[model samples]
Target: MNMHKLVKVLAPAGIAATVVTSAHVASGDDGINTVEAAESTSSNYKYQGDTGYGDGNFLLNEALIKTLEEDGDLAFNGHTIEASEDDYETRADKKSEFVEEHDQKFTLRDGTATKVVFPIQDETLSIDDVTEAYGDDFETTESKNGKYETYVYKLGDKKDDDKKNIIAFKVEDGYVTQGTIGYSKSY
Candidate 1:
């Protein structure tokens, strides 16, 4: 049996990134077999689940990209890939932007969603309804002018010690004007 590992390091905008790949080869009575595993620890964030919009919930990661491309509810506005030194890295890494029929916007990095914004033109979500769904485990911030308030809910259990998942809603006059869901490092 033989094992090989490959590591790639990259830094963009002062952030250190690392990608690790491991391969194992074995030859015996069963002839030869190879297994490979790859992990990118560049970002401390990991996809947990949907955005908690009930039936409208959209999960992040590559599956989201594939779903949007296939789902008839969304319009394919196009996407852009980031250029890197390695061809594999360049092909694997990309930032995709998508818009729903109601004008909701989503921005994904490397197939993982980094941000989602719901426009005011869409059907307004009630703050009371959101509270009823997610409970009271959240933080609130109000604008100085008292015109807007933002409620942020930290999603995920204690098992997710390193990663942080959050869903936020911006409300005005008791109606949610916008919403955002994101995954990132805890620290």
Candidate 2:
């Protein structure tokens, strides 16, 4: 099959559609088929493989994104993504859209996730959740952006920290929306 057609067929699974197609083409049927190529690409959405959670149990990667997409009823770290039609919405930003529940949000860029927002929907997650999750190793800054009061966290509190991932929590009525986990983009 042609590269364009293959990529278009798999684009719904990833932003690296062309890359996946290229890999498939390069493999030349060496036990790698279209479905396997797509699945492998979906499982490897890269973000430096870091999740600022307990013991770093969860790494926010393509598997997480696929779970949130394929199975909408996923719960993690005291947050949940409800399975409802209204739970998903497309944003004006070309790179992103979001699937939100009453307390959690997942942001996708070109069908792969770049952010996951967790709110204080339960005792396990609160305004101090990120600090607790990342421990004293994180850096924080408070700011107000329009109607949103944000608390930003940088994973490692250092001047030359190599980690590009950051999390931000939105507060309203004195309650944290818990926080958003995302990575910086370079164009």
Candidate 3:
């Protein structure tokens, strides 16, 4: 090749190499590195592994709920579904009129058994007993309506769906009349 042609080729190649090297230096990828490590804080919330009812082992499907209402021995986890009620809500539309809306119904109940396996032989269980069984790794919320005071215990998050694992105890005259342990709407 002629000297002039050789000069043109070599000059551009050298310039391109310098530009690439400079770009690498400018972009901060030159092997020296700095990493800011972050430590995540632990949550105070504790989770229960057993989850009382048969929830830890099997899901409480609709059929099981029906069986609980119909038969007395079909128990899951440690509780049985005693009864269910349809929930209704009042809603207002664009008009000034209010309408009644039906929401998901309450589907299960413990009926005063502390994880009591069905064929509930003896009526000897109490809500306090259930609370004691759960220990300190739980949260409680209470509400009063008429003659009944409801106590809800939030055990932990559910494994199958986006719901809370809870056990509700309905008390009247300082005695637990009903108990329910199952998944409920999170919010």
- Per-candidate TM equals 0.42, 0.35, 0.29
Predicted candidate 1 versus true structure: per-residue lDDT over 47-122, tens digit per residue: 2122223323222222222222222112112222111112123333475545342244555556533545554423
Query: What TM-score should be assigned to candidate 2?
Result: 0.35
| Candidate 3 regions with alpha-carbon error over 4 angstroms | 1-123, 136-144, 157-163, 183-187
> Which structure is stronger by TM-score: 1 or 2?
1
Clashing pairs in 1: none
Ranking by lDDT: 1, 2, 3
Tens digits of per-residue lDDT, candidate 2, 1-187, equal 3333444555676556334321322323464323334433332322211122222213222233343333322333233323222222222254656665434466655554555665343233344544454445444444434444665544422343333335455555444545565543310
What are the root-mean-square deviations of the candidates from the true structure over C-alphas? 17.0, 15.3, 27.1
Question: Model 2, which residues run further than 4 Å from truth?
Answer: 1-94, 101-103, 122-133, 145-151, 156-163, 170-176, 184-187
Q: Which ten residues in a row have the lowest lDDT in candidate 2?
A: 46-55
Model 2 lDDT vs. the true structure?
0.40
Error of 2 at 19 (Å): 34
Of 1 and 3, which scores higher on TM-score?
1
- Among all windows of 10 consecutive residues in model 3, the one with the lowest summed lDDT is 84-93
Of 2 and 3, the candidate ahead on lDDT is 2
